[model samples]
Target: MSLFKKKKDELNYLIFEVTRKCNLDCQFCYNHWKRDNDPKAEPVKEGYTFALKTLKTVFKQANPKHVTFTGGEPLLAERVNELILFCRMKGATVSVITNGNTGSTTEFSQLIKVGVQLFELPLHSYDQAVHDRMTGVLGSWKKSKDRMVGLMKFGAYVVPVIVITKQNFSQVGETLELLNNLGFQRVMLNRYNLGGAVLASPEKVLPSKEELNEAFKQANEIAEKRRLQLSSNVCTPHCVVDPNRYRNILFSNCSTEIRQRPLTLTVGGDLRFCNHSPDVMGNIFRETIQTILEKSSEKYSVVARPDFCAGCMRYEKCRGGCRAAAQQTGGSFNDVDPLVNTIKENEETEIA
Candidate 1:
């Protein structure tokens, strides 16, 4: 039997964390758990040799159709162009999520020349002070905004990302307006999960269910009016938005489906289920990619949904909400997601 029951073509998305270093210190960064103990933990600015070896394994095993280069910041990786070129040579289209800090116009041009299809840039809020405060950097908002504009001029497809948190939830309208003014065709708004840096400060960063629902409602309204494509992470429930209007924006919450695609290679050569997961299934340097994935499938098999979830109307699509969020907050992957519970409570209150 195949390690992946699905055909090879089904597993065609690979998310490679090219490096572990980042320029800005965002307060709610999901990768914060990686920085827990090491005082010397700075971004691994350059690692061509390790990266090349890892990419070789990925190409040999997965031969992905889409490769998303993420990191502390993929642009900060040494010889990143070479890595992007390697993916292109293997017939993979590439995209990158960066803090929008590094890279000259020439550097970005070179990357685009190598077939980078999209650039996902972060934009926290319209208010510079709020953004800067969340990022823990004095001038990140300006730098990121400037970079977004510069990338747009370069004709790179850029999507501005807003990681919704308590600090920025209320400003969702203004943020989308700013993105629209900047001429962005699409924007991504992700809810802050209780992982990484947020684990240390969930109370400070994570927004309440009411806050998140309201923000999405407002943002969706603005996005529709401006004809901007809005995408989101799996943290929100379908009930939060108009299902008919935002059907495409709602994401699947099934770990099984997610695990079947998008193999993640960390900077240290560890294969992860996702960036938010701390579990290292196997090391690509030591084991074959196929072998590593097989191990991951066995060890990280999908969690069984609770009985209550089976009867919910949105059960088929939502699949019991985000597994990582449940694990982080409720201490088990199978625990009912707090967001779902919150929505249920709201429904009960209304009925009462």
Candidate 2:
């Protein structure tokens, strides 16, 4: 299935960071790295008017098909509903990535009523203790689980996002079992990148290739047995698993093309080329969207690929893996993805 298709200049996706305040403290939280310098930084409490105007400008400029609200926790933002409604009014489908424990059922229903077509919920483990530990909240497991079910019952398309890490990699099957039992039809497995709060202790969270492959094997089996749809943000080499077994999980990463189309707007209205990187292209509220896009396009006109990937078979599709991953692992955005090295080692082992 073609997940995303857009014209050369059309912006079809917008990921907005609505706020920087979160109720739960996930140890592997990306926001931690984003806001570590000032944990107490205030949320965008009173930016509703400006936010709405800026969003209208974006809608008119890009005519996006989808607008996703994400953040330290988008539900915590005061005007999240308004933003969703505004995007919907502009002919864009809306979605929110939330921890799911912050708001009441009524509030979530209200969001659905306004225009939230999808809700992305994070579920790290089936074991309550492990989940709670990962989230750093004693009761987060129960709250998040209940919230997921509540949203599903409320008639929202709830997609479980499981971030795979050393702490929860071994529980892939159990986690899928819980998701299957919870009546979820699909789950997205996100590979833990060496960014955010984990950067300080990458060794603790980064799973080895063997562990990741094992997790994928178990997850694929469980998903098939349960007849659930499984997708992954982690771009693995084609030879890692049976192509047919992972066909559904496999995805193309056209970072160079995507970098120019999709726009990430921070809560403060800063236009960022990458969510993981703090580099700001421009401020949408201060400048025109066209100008920001032009500046970003010029700046990222050429994404240099690694020398080793010059003639690799997957070069066209994988585009040298994720640039964010490259930067996090090799300390340079243009460096070869560390996964390439791991995949090469795995290939040698298979031949020997």
Candidate 3:
């Protein structure tokens, strides 16, 4: 901890991707792969046992503030119940991010009993037709919405995140109003990053600065009128947008909204600093998770702001949006943009 800078001590959020298998084929999946031969592209068939033991060892070694399970869809990952139980035994709060069609109410009830409190469901649009077209499923839209109702009724924190795209960006205001009407806890408006199959459409759908400003503005109206709390990312501050007093509230957080919970572990049982960094300290299967963590703290160093981002105040806000994306697009932290940096040497041109 630095004396001059208040380093965040509450380090306990883990974005555990239990599996890589997904149900719906959304064009904008952040985890989509190209060659399919990448080792990272593979999803482990090993379920709760591997994950349970891994979680147990990691939790015992480090006290996490919270644990968030995501996926291809976490519920589809077998032994989800076991992982939840282990987190509870370790006294860590548990959350799951799902598309919401993987489990039944019974499965959800089991999760709730095991101390799972936070649930995030992604709904691309309020209109079923558009959403289904985007997700390539007939009822994916309704199923996600219905599942949100279930979680809310069960008294769990259910947040819905919409990946803004040309397909759904126009109706963001309406989306907020409809979700508020449905009794949702919160909603985050995230622009569609160029990843997955949607990369070609990035500029067509990503939120304009003005659109984001309106999203924040509309969220406030829903907060005041519908008694719902709403927010948008990179668009508004967390304290002002997240509703606390009223029954219904809407809010948003730009990506990196909250410090992400730690997720990856080294092949040696040491935890990977962030999902983006492929390096590892140790492996839970080989040794103890904490032992490795304590031995080598240097491996997980925080990312220093790169030169290209040094002049941008929003650099702190973005912190190199996605390291994985950076790697994929060949845009290191030092570059202004990926495509610009990728210009071939033979293709160099001089403008008059």
Give the Å error, residue 212, model 3: 5.9
What digit string (tens of lDDT, one per residue) describes model 1 on residues 139-213? 999989999999889888999999989999999899999999989878888887666666655779878778887
Among all candidates shown, the one with the greatest lDDT: 1
Q: What are the lDDT scores of the predictions, listed in order?
A: 0.75, 0.72, 0.60
Residue pairs clashing, model 1: 21-43, 21-72, 33-196
Error of 3 at 246 (Å): 20
Clashing pairs in 2: none
- The order by descending lDDT is 1, 2, 3
Cα deviation of 275, candidate 3, in Å: 4.7
lDDT for predicted candidate 2 compared with the true structure: 0.72
TM-score on alpha carbons, each prediction: 0.86, 0.85, 0.73
Candidate 2 structure quality by residue, lDDT tens digits, 1-352 = 4556432335678888777778887777754244345342345533566667667667655667788898878888777787888788878888899998798777898888986888999889999998888888898888889999988887889999888878899998999999899999889987775556665666677676777777787888887788788888655444443335555464444456544444688756677666554556788668866677776675554367678677777566565655555554435656665656656776799999
RMSD of each: 4.4, 5.6, 7.5
